[model samples]
Target: MELRSMRYFVAVAEAGTVSEAVKRVHVTQPALSRQIRLLERELRVTLFDRREGRLELSAAGRGFLPVVRDVLHRADAATAAAESLAAGRLVHLTIAASPTTLTDVVAPFLATFGPQDPLPTVQESSGPEALDRLRRGADLAIVSQQPPALWSTRTLAVLPLWAYVPRDHPWAGHETVDLDELAGQPLVVLDPTFRPRQLLDQALAEGGQALADPVECGNAQVAQALAAAGRGIAVVSDDPRFDLHGLRITQPGGDHLSITLHAAWDPGHHAAASLSALAERLEIFCRTRYPHP
Candidate 1:
């Protein structure tokens, strides 16, 4: 019949006495006994053998114990799943980030959650695509520029631009290079759709220099690889994961150019609360990992 009645039956069967079952089920002995009797009546089968002041399971009770246990287990599991979903703990979040941030920022943030917690799905794209993913129902988007004024956004980190020069290059000997000095140097840059490229272009414009025919790569690691191979200098965010073994990282001199990263989500989305919480965590993680000067 009812789950409560089934629970009472199981408790009494396991405890071997109505008195013992009451202690476990936290009901009066009479109330528990009534439930067991009601259950047996409903099933039209004798559930327990009571003799010599001890109770033992009857054939019917033995057969039903396992079934009742399974039912209770399933019910409990279903309840827990429902509660988790309502709390937003079980939602499968989709996070969109540029490839460099996915490695340098999102990966480390994920590491702190431990293996037991469900991980968010990551979508690696350039800034524009990442933002587009957010608009199309991604839970969060991590990008180098703030989202448009209408979107909900949290500033995560501000990173300075760094130049990766081939180890054999003359600039490798210096700690930093000026923007003017890099003028006319073939540059390995992220695709124009990415924010870092826009920032680099703006900085170059301000410095009265320009990259006439830069080698464009889809992501930061590729740009680094191209620079390492001496194709051009890679200008990117100061992400440590970019392999610098065959390159020297140089900071831009004077009014160093920087990019601000933000986590953005659509405010009207159903997961807005969860996404906002995720954005907050990302901001805290980025601040701890890359503290602003």
Candidate 2:
């Protein structure tokens, strides 16, 4: 019945006598014998034949050996799996970010670091619904707000901002584009579905500037991918791996805006330590990838 009693029964069967197995199991002979008998009653079958102060297997016991071993194997495996996950043996980290963040900022960040970590394995997705995956339980999410809202109780941090532009669209010649220089340029933007786009739109509105025709992408990478293809200019984080030939992200208007890059986890509940280490490594990753310099 109970897993412990099953272990006791199996040990006694293997040891050939309760007197012998008690020492092996560090239990008193009487206690071990009682447990074995309890297991026999629970299973409603005689498991051992005792004669001449020795033990012999019963037909039912022999038939049940593999089944008991299997249950023990599974329980052992469950513990092993939990330990492996804690040690980062699997090295799987799931991340979600807005598309714009992915292409223009998060994309470069991952490119620079995702493949480098020992045992690093990553899964990525984006959009409001995807961020909700994190709320439900995802390892990491690269989203608009520096601190995500859906699960405020998670481990979150910030990322710096970069000025994005169309490759070879003239800003490339300049070291940086000022806010005023962007005055009349058409802006390729993240869809309003994300929070970062909301922030940009709000700032523009407060500054009393109406945007030019806003071409929207669900994520930054789509915009960045387009920019790489010479489709449009965008505002994104300035990660070191970001390319100008593909698109341009430079200092703008003598201002530095660090995007709210957040890394978070549920206060309670998470993968074992190895997986937790993966989370910590991700934090280090965001820092190295998005250094202010």
What are the clashing pairs of model 1? Answer: none
How much lDDT does each candidate structure score? 0.76, 0.60
**lDDT for position 278 in model 1:** 75
What TM-score fits each model?
0.62, 0.51
- Please report the candidate that would top lDDT against the real structure: 1
lDDT of 2 by residue, 1-293 (tens): 78888788778888998888887789899899888888888889999998899888899999998788768756654564575567756444556655445555445555655453433323455445555655434555655454554443323246544456545566666655555445466666777755656656666675687667877887565666666666666655433233743222223344444455555444433444544565566556656654555
Q: How far does residue 117 in candidate 1 sit from its true spot (Å)? A: 4.3
Query: Residue 272 error for model 1, in Å?
Result: 3.4
Residue ranges of candidate 2 with Cα displaced over 4 Å: 1-93, 99-123, 127-131, 135-137, 146-161, 166-168, 225-232, 238-254, 270-276
| Candidate 1 lDDT, 133-198, residue by residue in tens | 754446678877668987899998887777887666786677666676665678888887777788
